[model samples]
Target: MAGDSVRDDELAWLDATEQAELVRGGELTPSELAEAAIERIERTNGALNAVVTPLFEKAVAQAASAQLPAGPFRGVPMLLKDMVCHSAGDPLHGGMRVLRDHGWTEPEDSHLAARFRAAGFVFCGKTNMPELATSVTTEPLAHGATRNPWDPSRSPGGSSGGSAAAVAAGMTPVAHGNDMAGSIRVPASCCGLVGLKPTRARTSLGPGHGEYWGPVAHEHVLTRSVRDSAAVLDTIRGMAPGDPYTAPPPSRPYREEIGLDPGALRVGLRTAVPGAAGQPHQDCVAAVDEAARLLESLGHHVEPSAAAVLDSPAILEGFSAVFGTIVAWEVDRWSQRIGRRIDLGELEPMNARTAEVGRSAPATQWLSGLHTWQQWAREAAALWEQELDVLVTPTLATPPWQLGELAPTALAPAELAAAVGEKIAFTVPFNITGQPAISLPLHRNPDGLPIGVQFVAAYGREDVLIRLAAQLEQAAPWSMARPPVSA
Candidate 1:
């Protein structure tokens, strides 16, 4: 069989499941898959700047190794967002210019990275992200911008923007993404991919640090298919030794949930942006309305309802305090790790301002913020307990905006925060409540940009989200929707 003869575009669209099947069936070797992905990245990344650090030689070598793990996704190529999860001996800058200048590399694989390796994924490279994964836009001074494949002028959404761009452009079948404030789902919304932020601690952050961003952060992948997301979760979801906490175990493997009946669910639809008087962009509102109608068609009951606590003033106040402190901690943590203090002048303006706030804050304020989040979470969770099985909303307040629209270097600290707050309005609340939320590419505007609608379930209810997402994926197949710039 001529495995090497596979067309680049054909390989580009093949999800991890299909790619792994080829390797398993002897139709393609892992080396061939790695080479194909590398060719695509090199060919397309010039425009996208998605894969910032190509690991071509390493990927090829790993693919050819007899010792490669024979797990579910063996031979599939993947990109790691250059934040949180680190691979041994690879540069892990977290989109910081200072770390990039210092030439930092991790000494060991993060538990998540190890799981990816064990699942038989070949690492194509590290993708771009905002500084410290702080901003919703991926235009870091360290690595520049990661452009959307659908529209080069626009952003792909960030912290995981590069990963989302790569997957959307068909440069890779899947890519790692972590979410603290919609980093995963926002990018998925922007890039027209499947982004799932599993319940907090669903995947461990261990051996280096326990909790990131005070438990608001969660890790997962952006994929073109719902099954891919579920399968990947099955591969990586578990607890590691010495972890601060872990999510409740799924009754069955997440992949099993893909085709299972979700049973007619009671879904709440909210088109309005919580706490904001104005509605989301017309396109975003339409996206939710369309998704709600689709859900109804699938035998689910859809109603206009949402957690009232989402509008609480304390939401922003608490999040701001905790976020600021995390920024300060990140700066100090990196300084201690690299054996040098990161001067404020070296940091981005927004982050510098945030760090200052964190430093100036009294310890009681931080604790008070945590208390507010805790109480708010309980209040928000009550909606699921009494009323709805799922809540549907626009993943982002608007469609993908132009690059530099929210650049930290260009905007004032308050200006940047306000802009970012708009994008994160719907998605951030779940991150706070530790619930599983997914963004699905269900609509595209007249301009041809994809608009994603989000469906969130109670904490540790990824199984429910998976079933619904897979049903939607089948109902409105997006696999054939190629971007203008793609592999």
Candidate 2:
């Protein structure tokens, strides 16, 4: 098929699976797909500022190369978030001005990047992210801000905001994203995509470090379809050599889980922000209510319930302790790698303050914080063990807010923490428990912005999530819901 026959919007909306099928069937060469994506990025990225580093020439060459792997997603174009998962010879700034100023490029591909390449994804570019992936918004000093495609005034959510924005705006069918404190899911929620944070260690963090930000961080992708997410996971999910730990391997390929019936499930619904004084926005609450009803109609047992331990304020204290220390360690690690100390002034104010807190925290306090989290996780797991198969909540407390509203530069440390706490209230608990969670775009507010609902499964139970998410996807299809600023 000739490229001129297909509308650019049609090609932009095709998921990776569909794009791969066309390439495999010889209807379109990989070069056509790559070039089409590049054109879309060139046309759309200026408004969204999603792709920070375009590799169009390299992508076109790779797509046309005979060496391109013939894996499931062969010939598909995708964007990598410029954090955690690095691509060889590509600029890996981690959204920091210091790294960009130093002109640092990753010498080798991360294990995850290799898996993506093996699966036949052409890396068109790296997406923008918050500095050091510290803030929940993608307004890094290095890359400016990535505007939401849904509404330019609002945020796309971060540190995976650029990835989410790119996918939503149709620059790419899918993009890599990592979640520490709702980075992937929040962005997915904001951008109207599927964002899955697989169980801890499901995807390796290797040849560099074992775990990122303790056990709370996990890497995956934001895609327009549940099956795309499942297919991508099947390709990248595994342990690397000398890894710290690994999630339980799926009984079969995760792709097989799609369309499989998720028999009658006992789902608990929660709309209140745990440990916070107020409930989420009315729109968010309504989203959960609608999702619960939809689940009930689909033969799942949905009830108004939540784990009691979620209300404990102590959870925040423990999370803060671990989070702060990790930031400090990250600063130190980068300093050693760059062969110079990273002055506090070089970091964003929020991270600089967090580093200070982390540096001052005694080892005993850090350990105590870990112990506290472990204790709470054990307690929280009881809800699943006794009654719930899945827990549903609003992915974020509200729909996407204005871009600068949550900027660390505009708020004091405590103010920023409180604001971030509200946004991540429902998503972070599962991160601590090392369970699988996914954000689905099930609702949209009056303003036409997406409001996502999160579903949590027991530890290492991504199969459960995939099945249910697929079922929900079918029940309320969202693939055709395009944003205002899109390809």
Candidate 3:
């Protein structure tokens, strides 16, 4: 599996699209690509801690397999996010010390994993994340935090932080990640890459499941190129029989959508999300304004508008309840598997808090939260119809935070709420509404860290977001910008 090392000149930290092209054209074999990625991962991951659980041997075996997809990205190397999804023979710790023991995965593959293999990706193993993929920073108890490539002292944003960091540092062209609450987009913003949270159900999650909690998680990839994101989505988007619901399919392939000219769109601009409290940092605001100007220059109509508040104070309180419910369910499931009554003492502080919240919630309160979420979704959908092709906002209210700053144990519940509120002020609303949103790296801070401009489209309108991303990428190219840690 050895040959001439990837030439430095040929290593511009290419995205999945470029890697796929080279591999498909016979310029690079999967083994060579995997080797290059593994080399970079070994060289840098010690400092970054991005690839928390490496499956190098399995990846090598997979890469050496003769059978591979004939698609454009056949024979590419990719990494999986650490939480939720399971890969056969991979020790998935789920980013929690309590659950570090390997769990059983079916002999057969999950649909998503099957699709990845079919796309010719050599699975390079899992990346780090917050416990249960619950938080925005990858500081789980089992594996230490994944450091930001741009600034080692800062977080790369998580639960998909490792995926973002790996791609940003060129350990891989692109990596599979999930967004349950700005997970993908937050890391994309911090790491200066393209991350799209496709419409709910756009990508199937299982052969044995439906929607995850109905509001939050969505499957997608984080990449350097919009085309790469689209290509991955194209391969995975479809509904399995058990899916609760499938998002409307695009008329064309997602990859093709990326190149299609998005005609002048009526973009609604809102720096502040009403009732969604937080003061966006100057850098974050600047990123949004610059994106607006860029859009105007690209012939799109940018109109100022305040985001409509779909949920009031009463409904806003329901979010934590819903989250807690998820925590309790996972804890119970794990407890049963481990043959012990799981005590909150062994869990991370945040996990403990979530479990407490869940335990304290009355059945009536859980139902109320679900009702509020559904009502808000309806209201938000209606508002989108009245105005705006898409909503633009700061992907994050603040720039990247110092490493360990947002550790769940360090902050009190109020402080944690306030901090989370500030960091992802604009993103959670879309997650609640199940709308498609993307983070485009359009601005750089003085220190050269990437700042992302987020554009959110109406529910199930991923095509529109892809088209918009392509337009923005063309207008203000972030491809030329590379982090100092880039290979």
Candidate 4:
């Protein structure tokens, strides 16, 4: 094994798997890798503002200690989204000025945070997010907008935009993100990275709670390589004792599924979402058309299919009801946890209106909304069971927008909600049904910004998605691509 140290400049683009291999092969020490990452963070964070809180000294101390575990991602540097993935005593501001001002801190590691540590990831810092992670763009009054590395004038998609931009810019190989609406895949689409939202309960959300935002959320990572994503899933996928949900066990490790051919499959392709948000840009639809052709070449039967539920007023209304009520509950929960009232000054108008709608709505209304979505879930999942082995679509209605195009701070409540709904139409439906979905950067626009192709599998069918993603990645590789402001 070579004992030579790799230069920091040379380390910028290596993914987590490659970095870990270098450490195990004696080419680099954990301390050296951590320092290189810190230097990269210092070098580029000023440009992107992706990282909200730097824990460089703490990461260095941990990496240099003898107590570091020997796990799959040994020595790999990581950043956590400043939401529920909290570490004891760490500042987990959730991109809210109130929390940052009052010095809110997590008492201990949430279950997922502990899992990241057990996987041998060294946490360097917390990434920026929208206020309460409610916005689809990462601009918050607490911390200014986290700019896209491809074009700083545009967004990196949110609320996981910070993690997506940091990983795409080479500040870290992998960073934590969770999908409630389209948080994970939206940012992945905008930032030119791979993001997978595992089947609900495929990962434990505990030491915090059984689930977040009901079943509309799942925790995972954003990565440059499909293999890295698969490997990370292998390392952290498990059920906690008290978890409210449990995914069916995989036949084998997710990493083992990579490179293995996913036999001829049935693929349903849809280019535009229905309803008010139905006007998809030509560039976005073009990306999906490109993916359909590529899949056809790979021998998968690709056919046009629409998710009819997405067009239903009942479904849309139910989505808004569930979303509003959940937001209200969370606002009350977080504020009460700190023994304070919901400060309007600290909350964005869009989110404040959501909470008000929830609080003011009759109890029957909230129950009816929950019941409506349950029915919608069954109807949506039936499309997959009766027909599709996989569904392919453009990840967004448009490419990453200019930074203020959907500003949470300036828009009226209804307008803001509609704006978010428009951008996230396709991705949100999968979240509603607890299915596994992944965003792969398959094409670039005429001006050279990335556009993602999203593949969604039936519930608990991540194995199918991972296998297909690996296959697509190999057939039309995007690994060599880099953003202009990358490390």
Candidate 5:
């Protein structure tokens, strides 16, 4: 049952946790599983171009030396997205050519990596991403665009697009992804997978800064099942030694949350435009309406509600200042290490533009943005306290776009932002507020592309969102749905 051919087809397609279980149960060995996954990557990665850098040799070596954790996911194979999170000895390109020929990882794993290993995941290698993961689509100058596994004609949503694409193409069951402004959820929406952004600090970000740009970026996973996402969260939840914010401990393991009855939650359903720059696509709106109706059928009280309107310019301006500063810092550190001048010349136009914007930003802009975000978070939290258990919106404002639609050369920073603004109308504010959110694959267009419905909860309320998502998963099973390429 476990062989090279099957690795390319069946084994590669199993969820990461299932592969680990197969290894733990003695149905297959970790070495065999690793080889099979390696084979699948060799066979399909060229077409999908999901994995930019290969680590099969190291993966096989690790498979031989490492012992599987006695957890639910014992010997599963997985990929780490390139932008954030690092493993010892793995080449980290950050999806940029300037960092192309570099190597050197810390002696210890990032908290995200450590937790994934604790969950029984073996890192086969790193996946692709946009340069610096600043863009919405996954086309980095360093690594060519990652195609959607479903059509190859459309994009797998950004930053985590390669990880999602890999999973969609059956190259791996699950992959590590980060979300600050929809990286994980966007790709999941594009590729038809379950993506969850746990509440800020639900998972640790350690061996670096105290927090990731004030919770705008959180690490998560993209998977095929809600249970898998829940299981990973259970393993990863908890603060490490240096977290700036620590979410309260879960009263029980999250695996139990998947099946627990989230009885009669007052769902705040709204298809209104986000305070962001643009409106969602028509199909995205219809998908939200359909999800609301389904929740009604499930006996949940679905009603319209709205939170305080955000100061759009202040939010963007503020977010940009902090975002640009992070980029500048990372670029400087890497440039010094690589012993080369990594000027804007080496970067894509968008990357260069963002760096320039950051450089030009006044210190006051960052301070003001921080204050604005804090004020908005407090105001939004109060509104949530009074009116809703969950806020429903389209995960993305538009369905997957054609492959080169958001190319760096083709679009300026403003144009790209505007283009992405229209599609991802609702994601960033949650990032700013540090709310827990999940993207459920609930609707499909006539062409069979999946659309995700996003459910967001108050800060530190991932348990509530997870429980609710589990209910929705059962009411409308998306597990059997496969992208066209896989089918």
Candidate 6:
């Protein structure tokens, strides 16, 4: 087979779908593709700090080996976020300084990792993230902050910031990223990519734990194309044997939904997060306005909305008990596995105190908070069934903030909840509701920072999102909007 002579600069611009097709068509060998990615990572990672643990040798060996699986993404390179994603026998620091200090490695592959391998993905490296994934900005003390490819001085939304950066900069076309609250979509917004927080139980987070934050957290990917997101989701979405919950199965593979007509759908436009946290920045508000116009242009009905569930202080109170306690649990579990006690001093101040507050909170309060979030989820989901088919809002209240500005370490757990919750205001409510939400990079501020517009669908309805996202993506393409500090 004759391979196409893909130049390094030209190769950097292709999305995963294009890259995989080129490989399949004998225009790019898997080995050549892998080497190009490694070289790109080496060239760009120093400035981006996106890939913390380079698996260059491993990726090269796997790429050249004949023992590769015949999966859809075969020959395409990817990165895993430094969190629940694990590759057996590889360093797996989840952006935690304590684990990094100990040189911890995962003993086995997470189910997701196994599926990724099965899909013909070459594991390139692990990306940087915030400490304990507690912050939206990826300024991890362990690996340092992952700078936005859009603007190095600004933050890439975290804790998947590293993955987003790498993907944005063309170091990798797609990367693994999980959402506890807004980890996936926030960074997608900041980095100008497609980030989908799948429905609760849509994908497995197995062997480690069944649920997180009373089931708000989810695992997914960050990619430049809607079709890439859909294809990856098709490859990875399923119920593992021991999963506690199972999202209703899609009628067919989600990839098929990419170009499908979404019909005349009712869309709710929420420009600002309601309540004391205040309006989204003017850029963010304008993004919503712009997205509404775009959706209407596409023949969808758009109407004004106020996210009532997020407006209440109850969200912070209810979120605190579950978030704090689960964090404490994960830390203790990891400590036991490593056979070492976590010195409070070793953890970032906010995370250390977060665990402390979690430990002190009553078990009853944790249970109560779980119930509250579920209720909030129901109320939020009701909008779709009653008045709208999708809800659109600014992914973050504002565009990317400068590094170190949002990680307020001095605050108490409740105070931190108010602060952190406000930053992820639009995305978290859907996490609470177990609905599928997506952040589309549809608009850019005057400063050229991307302002992602979020569209949330009812529980287990990512097909609707994929169809709508594909339409929106075609309306306003962002693939050519590469950051200045790119591969």
lDDT measured at residue 454 in model 3 versus the true structure, 0 to 100: 90
The alpha-carbon root-mean-square deviation between model 1 and the true structure, to one decimal in Å, is 1.1
RMSD, every candidate, angstroms: 1.1, 1.2, 2.0, 1.7, 2.3, 1.8
Candidate 1 lDDT over 442-471, as tens digits, reads: 999999999999999998899999999999
Clashes (N, CA, C under 3 Å) per candidate? 0, 0, 0, 0, 2, 1
What shift in Å separates residue 252 of candidate 6 from its native position after superposition? 1.4
Cα lDDT for residue 445, candidate 3: 84
Write down the TM-score for model 6: 0.97
Q: Which ranges of candidate 3 are over 4 A from the true structure? A: 1-9, 101-108, 273-278
The TM-scores, one per candidate, come to 0.99, 0.98, 0.95, 0.97, 0.94, 0.97
Error of 2 at 180 (Å): 0.9
| Model 4 residue pairs with clashes | none
Q: What is the lDDT of residue 266 in candidate 2?
A: 94
Greater lDDT among 1 and 4 belongs to 1
lDDT of 5 at 54: 86
lDDT of each candidate versus the true structure: 0.92, 0.91, 0.80, 0.88, 0.79, 0.86
Encode model 6's per-residue lDDT on 1-487: one tens digit a residue: 1245878888888888899898888888998889999999999999989999999999999998898777998989999998887999899888887889889999998889989999999999999998888888888779888899999989998889999999999898999999988999999999989999999988888877677556887988999999999999998899998888789999999999988999999888877675555678999989989988889999998888765655866677677668779878878888898998777667777788778888888999899998887777677666778888898888988889887676546456467656776788777777777899999999999999999999998889999999999998889888888788999
lDDT sort, best first: 1, 2, 4, 6, 3, 5
Per-residue lDDT of candidate 2, residues 141-245 (tens digit): 888999999999999998899999999999999999999888999999999999999998999998687887877889899999999999999999999997898
Query: What's model 5's lDDT at 393?
Result: 86
Across 1-487, the per-residue lDDT of candidate 3 in tens digits comes to: 3235447335537777887777767777888888777888888888889997788988888788777666567778899887556677666677878767545333456678887887788888789988877778887778888888899889999879999999998888888899877999999999999999988888887874576755677888899998888888988888876877888988988888867888999988877644656547889888889888989998999998766563255346667658788788788877886788788878887778778788887888778887888777777787679888988888887889898788867788557656765566567777788889999999988888888889988888889999889888887787877677756
Model 2 lDDT, residue 352, Cα:
89
Clashing pairs in 5: 20-75, 397-423
